[model samples]
Target: MVEEKSDRKKTNTIIFDASKKEPFNINEGYKILHRRLKNSWKVGANRDAIRQEILRTCDVFVLAGPRMKLQDSEIEALKEFVSGGGRLLVMLGDGGEKRFQTNVNTVLEEYGIMVNSDAVVRNVYHKYFHPKEAFINNGVLNRALLECAGKRVDSAQDKRNSQGLSLVYPYGATLNVSKSSVALLGTGTACFPLQRPICALNQRQNSGRIVVLGSCHMLSDLYIDKEENNKIQDIIFQLLTREDIKLNQIDAQDPDITDYTTVPDIGYLADRPFGCLEESEELPSDYMKLFELNLFKLDNVTLPAVLESYEELEIKHEPLGLIRPHFESPFPPLTPAVFPPQFRALKDPGLELFDLDEEFSSQMERLAQLTNKCTDEDLEYFILEAGEILGVFQNSSVKRQATAVLDHIFTQVCEFKKLNQD
Candidate 1:
């Protein structure tokens, strides 16, 4: 059977991927990934925010891009929300798109941050998210790079490996931050130039608490595995579940009232990690506010999930662990045979552009299989057509009118077939 995502209700991780469409079928596309990255409590009750709920329920949020670029209303809402104390979880995508980053960075710059998209930047100092078997500790990660690397490294690089600096663009960009801002991790091998830094931080002098992370792979469907073992996950855990900042640390003396907003009836919200506090007065009604909520595990051990009959998905002894299909039981034509053969040709060093990596080809082969509905042998030819298109473009050295056009076409086609299955 051709692989396709199902729209089933499951605990929320309602994603906002810059690369995919709205309301992704997280139950299947990202369910396993979520479980791996999540704390014990979020597993059972699908209490996650899909779209609106994501903004509403989260204390601090994480986002992957090539999908959700910033806009004016979104910026205004995010700023007010964070200034009111909204925690943000952010990452950078391919720094190869100027037009997309231009508008996105506009929203971010007002926050004291900026995004740069250009040239493929790569360097030895930069660490990739390799598989478990490939995990390694290469060097002492200057905490600055760690922000982009992750709180948890699947493998630690040897600290002795040291002393290197390089610049490469078109890879992933950096958040050129304002003076009030500081890098949580140290500088690394390559970073895209962000023309405006303080802008992404909402022009705030203290947006460090805002938590800006670079590197978008952390949450992608293909990259979530990296997050499973990322050192960044620890940072996320600390940021999200703990709602208290020591009350005694700030200057509480009778001063600086103009710059600060006050929460009137603050009482004991919790005692362990510190205390959760809120303005005893009514808060704004905006779904995009920055109010924080320290989530406790979904202690109600049961949750709902849909499953293909051949596979039995048992949960943590919870009755809610069953999936309801859109129309039928045992997803029809359940055979792996229909899936496409993900073939990878050995690289020909003779041709740089012709060197299609196994990863790229694997993705295209599967995407093409699904997009053709795995039924149209004629349209199925586009798989080869697309690869040839890349080959031809590289050979002729012609600039494109638009980037990602072919990607858009292919992805839309795949999505069409995925949703159209009846």
Candidate 2:
């Protein structure tokens, strides 16, 4: 007898990467987006190093704003994941390597996608924030998304209209992808006349789909709800739900990183070791020394030690704990002195630096000869030379004298041209 086959669909799973020092915190700011997907799919964080076995189970692998370079094994696992029909989404921000300091291009370039190092800016009307916060109104929606957008309002189709909707382009970089890749968004040429592409998608016939977004800020908590950023959430959901994309189950092990185990001691937006004010050179040296000492003390304290020390200090559970030092001192502090004493204002001595009567007489004689007997060509040459003279003198007093001479020469040239026209 033939056994009856079950017809249940497999449960989709998505994992947001946190092993690469990504700036956006999914648990905190991105909780809204996370909560939306958790209802239907198994959404979780990949805190440990990326493993091939993990990717095999995950239907969607999202690497957003990675601040460090991916290990060779990680990159291979991602590439293999997509090749095995798993959807992959890569989101990068502006300042490319200079900002995230990650070697993202090494992985993307192999897939015919290149992320530029420059920031995409909208010099025209932007959100109330900085100019880098570009606003994108023109986006070429995909066919599936177009159908969703064309649906009537309040209808079932309207719920997914976010697919073809335009999005707010925050501080993002531009992309260079292959011609086969579908361009989803093109930035205006107002700020950058090139009109570069910012978002693209490449769907293999039956393999995994690759989606690239230039800016990670669109998904960020602070700006995700602003403007049309909700479209990002919609698109991400669609990518995660697509059933055609397949992944394999594997009994693989995580990679061993004996040579790549060390991480740099640089600070990120999350684990800032020092306060913003402590970075300024104007701050007192003693205060900085004390601040450094406090940071050192705090670094060695474990979670339990921190809680125990808090009880010893009898500090409330307020935002700023009383155990932290104010870093202010009452002792006699060194007086602040001007940094560059050489650039101080120059004094006007009683004696004149140059004999104005003699200099003026010489300039007047030269001008008189050039304006009267000199041809129009000579006057034009003098005007050009006079502009060069003004450029050479940088001091205000010297520049003023040079300007007066330049103006005199320019006037003569203008008057000479007028006479010639007459």
C-alpha lDDT of all candidate models, in order:
0.40, 0.66
TM-score of each: 0.37, 0.51
Query: For each candidate, C-alpha RMSD in Å?
Result: 37.7, 29.6
Compared with the true structure, what per-residue lDDT tens digits does model 1 show for residues 191-273? 21212121122212222235554444433355444523334445444543343422111211211112112233345433334
**Poorest 10 consecutive residues by lDDT, candidate 2:** 248-257
Q: Candidate 2 overall Cα lDDT vs. reference?
A: 0.66
Residue 25 Cα positional deviation in candidate 1, in Å, after optimal superposition: 7.8
lDDT of 2 by residue, 191-306 (tens): 44245667767666556777888888878777888876776567555754564422111100111101112235466635866545555556666765546565455455477887
